[model samples]
Target: MHQLDPQMPPVLVFHGDADKLVSPRQALALRDRLLASGNRCELHLVPGGGHNFGQDVPAWQEKSRALLRDFLARQGLLP
Candidate 1:
């Protein structure tokens, strides 16, 4: 985070609140650092979700797709 660039492209992050592999606090810190660096960042924390949360769940998969679509649209990366 110390080497983050303010002019870098926006970022979309998804982290599981119950993730054991990586802490959710790390994602929060990343979001904060990105925003502090004048970069755009969207953070989504899935409740009761593990490291690979939403990978096997149909509902979560759809939700993730929708979020990605919206994020790309907002960045003008999608039509």
Candidate 2:
């Protein structure tokens, strides 16, 4: 658990507001846990998006990709 180790690396989470398989609240809960442990966490809630953006919405898909890329760059995960 993050609370047992505050030195863990930060995390970036993405959840769709319209997801039916998994609730967005789960993402928020994990983010809260990470933050409570003094670790950095980012959660991006995609509006009108479903799981994996499988709703066939191009705009939401692009937005999700952009957010992911930005997060990776900010965390030095992308070159």
Candidate 3:
């Protein structure tokens, strides 16, 4: 579907190394498809992380928030 159109809304994806529900490698595949069609996208691979980082530790949560804030700010998604 998206392959037929190059212009599309971008999505930011974060994958954990220990995610069991979804393969982290799938993120890369999605990224490749978006890239092939000249669509905007972002991907972040977190190490020592799992499917639920928010339930892991306070530090990880803070770090995740910080990264998200930075990305949004850079993309002008947040004012």
The RMSD of every model to the true structure, in order and in angstroms, is 1.3, 2.3, 2.4
Minimal lDDT window, size 10, model 3: 1-10
In model 2, what are the clashing residue pairs, if there are any? none
Clashes of 3: 0
Q: lDDT per residue, candidate 1, 5-40, as tens digits?
A: 999899999888889999999999999999999999
Model 3: residues >4 Å from true position, as ranges?
1-4
Q: What TM-score would candidate 1 get against the native?
A: 0.92
Put down candidate 2 lDDT per residue, 5-78, tens digits, no spaces: 68888787878878889998888888888888888999888877778764645676677778878888998999
Whole-model alpha-carbon lDDT for candidate 2: 0.79
lDDT of each: 0.89, 0.79, 0.74
- What lDDT does candidate 1 reach at residue 13? 94
Better of 1 and 2 by lDDT: 1
Deviation from native of the Cα of residue 51 in model 2, angstroms: 1.4
- Candidate 1 regions exceeding 4 Å error are 56-58
Which residue runs of candidate 2 sit more than 4 Å off their true CA positions?
1-4, 54-56
- Clash count, one per candidate: 0, 0, 0
| RMSD (Cα, Å) of model 3 | 2.4
